[model samples]
Target: MQLEQILRERKEDKDILLMTHIVLGYPSFEANREIIRQMVENGVDCIEMQIPFSEPMADGPVILKANQDSLAAGTTVEQCLEFGAEMAATYDIPFLFMTYYNIIFKYGEEQFFARAKAAGIKGFIVPDVPPEMGTTFLKEAEKTDIAPILIYAPTSTPERMTHLDSIAQGFIYCVARRGVTGKKSEFGEGFNDYLALCRKSTRLPIAVGFGIQDKDDIKALTGRADIAVIGSQTIRLVDEHGPDAVGPFIAGLR
Candidate 1:
């Protein structure tokens, strides 16, 4: 039941999985749990539990605010782990941690991956730590069997894609655009070409995120991508309409 295997199975069935993101302790611990339950019930295939950090450079305005607000409300790393452990145990889908490298560095990579594995986190999305600078981190991840998923941006060179393809585990996170997460992506011919290039690079499941919004966005990724990542938009909907809105919104996407 490793994450990579789950993704492969989904692909083999020709099912495009929905991968959702949530900033841990964003609104509150209790609320976050309910939100996750709703998402799973709505058919979310994987969950990315983002550990709120001070400077989440890869996040857009909405998620950045969520991170700051969570920190302001005294949401510590231990609380996130506790929340993650509970959710991972409750949900059958793959649970991965998405955070900046500094959090892992400060917490000690070995200890961090070990604790994440213990807490049922099957993988990680360390945005700042590219493969070249992640030798030790990868070593620890391999030892713990925690997949440190790599990312491929639209701007990545062929050589860069080849390098990333070599080490990517569970899945490859393909950022749809050049900027941070949020906004709506225009997945046209150019975006299709980018996805094609990414597919050529890695045999792992390619998850397209960063600006993915509605059902049309998911439809746009139907054949080319294995997973659709919806982050900021889902958070916004939950914040505006409460966690109850999440299930229906995800259902609409499906």
Candidate 2:
């Protein structure tokens, strides 16, 4: 099934989808494989395999540290892709890539898309690449059947939302708050209204991320969002309690 279709079906079944994010080769490539296996067994609907970049501007301290550590461990882009391919081949759910625009640019856009598709990447979550500047990248992704997910911030204008939704496929990543990832998100007033606006702006599935920590946060998104994305907190959990804690923590979310 298509990525969006799978997400929509989950929503229809009244199941709140959980999308987990992990930095590929964070602790190590081998450990990442186990972490992903556990996440899947624990009820992760989708997995965002982040290719560690030198500067992940949209991420907070936790992810930043993971990126640094992964890079320091000599985690290359090729290794990430190989890992993604292995996971995609092994798993039944969607596997997406989360990385910076520079990584794709340096790796060659066409080459990147082609290789990612061949590696079993269903889509991409490029935090740094905006729709306006990512024309060629979007076109190439379309040709390769790779969905290019777009993000919308709380501060985004209606015009911006409409523009982004026009190009976004697979899902619209609704950034829970205005800042970077990691901090706890206090869902303020009009949260439902904001999600409604996003739904009106796009036909794609809406997955909210950033600052999503506990089961309470996941429950809070109940009918408002189609998918709940937990990133920094997952990494923090693994860092504090080892990979075994991953499945239990994700299980709690469900």
Candidate 3:
């Protein structure tokens, strides 16, 4: 409930909240530090830090390349945990670790949960771990007070949403389209209906992710979704323009 309460309280003023994603060591930890400082300074509600998995299956080309490069550069789970702790303690916003389930499995679920809790991480978004396969993962998360965030795709049945809602905490990540992240998502009648199903199925705040780009996109989500997540675009901004470009880009989103 810590994360849920934070969002509810923060949402009292803003029509919609912003959440950003970063691969921990993509440019460099130094660049990560500067980017996060700017993000928090500019009023980002929360941030999800991806721990760079070799096979980030749900990600599009941009993020997939970041993960591969970070791993090739020898980024380790310990470094990510340390960085997470630093960010959480230094910034007021919530931080979540978004990675593949294999990372957790290899690190040992109990230890990962314990370390993440100690690091002050508020949630986990392991994209590939469905509830059926995540029984132990979810259990450890609950015991450690870490929200186990679950994803809902457009194809998910009403039954699937209900099942996911029963287990998810913090919020439900509603993938804006049928595919992976990066490509622009067109919001149409079908999209609205999909968001409606997401809202109806989960008491948790609905955060719409994949391909949410600028202010218009954020405006589009304002009433329909509680949080609008920005992922690959930010990474692209950092890559093309450098980490310093993140602040203005994020500021312009609202």
Candidate 4:
């Protein structure tokens, strides 16, 4: 099924789908596998797995450390794909790999798309690759039936937003704040206003991320976006208390 269809099903229930991010081999491959299992068992509507890279520019310290640790542990792109394939075979959920464009370029877009599609990955979010530079990969993705999800921030200009909305396939990742991918201060002023503007600009599902800590934040976002993506908070929970914490933390979200 398409990513939009999965999101639309969630919307029909009047519930915001939760899409959480994880880094494969963060603590260890075993820990990563358990975490993926925990997330699936915890009612996560979708999952975004990060392929560890040496330089994760958009991520904050916590995720950066996780990536570093995973890389130091000798995690490779091929191993990340293998892990994802395992999870995909075991669970029936939409999975998107979030990574920078450099990795794809390095691995060769054709090879990367082929491996990811074979592994049951439905989509991807390349934050650093703007729409202008994404055409080549987008074409490759379309051929392989892989959705290329786009990211739009609160500070995006009208032209940029419109352009992104036009090209976005799976869902538009609405960055809740103007800064990096992590918890933020206050969700910033005029947050909902920005969400409303994004809603007006695109028919695609919009999943808001960054600084989504408590149920109140999720409540505040009701009817504003199709999904609430809680990354750093959930990742922090896993880092602090291990994979078992996913159930309780997700219960808190509900």
Candidate 5:
């Protein structure tokens, strides 16, 4: 099934769904494989396997460091793609390829799309490639059955959100705050208003990411958002603890 359909169907059983992001080959693909297993076994609904890049603009320190470290350690795009295929084949949950547009441009857009499709990847989260700049990327996404995940920021106007929804497929990744990933998010009045606009903007499921950590954060997104994304925190957990720490942490979120 398509990612949107899978996410929508998953929501029938749970009030909120969980999606996680991991920088492939951070510690190592060995650890990455294990991390994905723990996440999947502990009820993670979807996972975005980030192909590490040199300059990850959307990331904060933790993820930025991971990206740099992964690249420095000789992590290649082919390795990440192979790891993604392995995870998708092993886990029943939908897997997405998240990376910068430069990686796609260097790899050849349609070739990347074809490779991702062959790898069993269900979606692409190229944050740098907005629909306005990604005509071929969007078209290839449609043709290859890969969903091009669009993002909406807290500062986005209602009109802009509507425009995003027009070209967006799969789901809308609603960034919880104005900044990049890592810092913990505090859900309050402003967040509720932003979420309201997010809901009003798209028919696709809205996934609230950037600084979403711990059960309380997940609880806060319960009815308001369809999916709560866990990014840097998981990388932090793996760095601080080990791959085993992921399963228990994930199980307690809902």
Candidate 6:
């Protein structure tokens, strides 16, 4: 099934489907493969694999360090694709790739899309690419049945949000804060208002990310979103306790 269908079927009245992110080459290719396997076994509905880049402008300190470590260990984009294809062959979950525009440009858009489609990738999240580009990559992605997910921050104006809603497919990533990706404070008083605004603008699935750490936050976010994306927290868990801790961490969220 598609990512959207899986999310809809898994979602409960107060339960949001969990979508987790991890750097694909973090530490090493083998480690990354094991991490993906563990996350799937831990009940992650969708997996966002971040390909390591020399300059990850949108990433925060934690992710940047992880990327650096992965690159230093000799993990490349090709390895990430091979690993993803291996996982896709066995798992039925959606595999989405998150990367900067430069990587796609360097690899050639058509080449990237063709390889990703052959490898069973389901979607793309290019945060650095704006709608104005409107390149052939977008068209090819649609043709290949790969959805391009978009991100919108909390500080986005209504006009921008509406525009994003129109172009976004599969899901809209609602950044919990205005900063780069990392952990942060709890959802404040205006959280619901922000969610309400997104709901008003989009019919696609809405998933919240950034600073979502524990069960309390998940419980507080119940009914506010269709998916709860926990990235930094899951990465932290993998870093501190290996992939074995992912299952219990997910259980805590539920």
Residue lDDT tens for model 1, 1-254? 67899878766755588999999988888889888988999888899999999999999999999999999999988888888889889988889999999998999988888889899989999999977899999999888888889999999998899889889789999999998999899988998899999999987889999999999999989888999999999899988998889989988897
lDDT of 4 by residue, 1-254 (tens): 77788778867876688888998888888887887787778778889999998899988888898899899989999999998898888888888899899999999999999999999999998888886878899998889988899887878887788888888888888888867767653654588678888888887999988777778888877777888888888778887887888778887786
Residue 81 error for model 6, in Å?
1.0
**Ten contiguous residues with the weakest lDDT in model 3:** 1-10
Ranking of candidates on lDDT, top first:
3, 5, 1, 2, 4, 6
Give the per-residue lDDT digits (tens) of candidate 5, residues 61-171. Answer: 999999999999999999988888888888899999999999999999989999999999999998888788899999999999999999999889999999999988899
Clashes of each: 0, 0, 0, 0, 0, 0
The whole-model C-alpha lDDT of candidate 6 against the native structure comes to 0.82
**Model 2 weakest lDDT span, ten residues long:** 6-15
**Model 2 C-alpha lDDT per residue in residues 73-171, reported as the tens digit of each score:** 999999888888899999888999999999999999999999998988889999888887889999998899888899988888888999898888899
Candidate 4: residue pairs that collide: none
Q: List the residue pairs that clash in candidate 6.
A: none
Residues 1-254, model 6: lDDT tens digits: 56566667767544678888889777566776777777778778888889988788877888888888888888888888888788778787888999888888888888888899999988898888887695676787777778888887878888998998887778999888877878574677787788889888887889988888888878877778888888888788888998778778886787
Please list the C-alpha lDDT of all candidates, in the order they appear.
0.90, 0.90, 0.94, 0.85, 0.93, 0.82
User: Which stretches of model 4 miss by more than 4 angstroms?
Assistant: 185-189
Residue 49 shift from truth in candidate 6, angstroms = 0.6
Per-prediction CA RMSD (Å): 1.0, 1.0, 0.7, 1.3, 0.7, 1.6
Better of 2 and 3 by lDDT: 3
Clashing pairs in 5: none
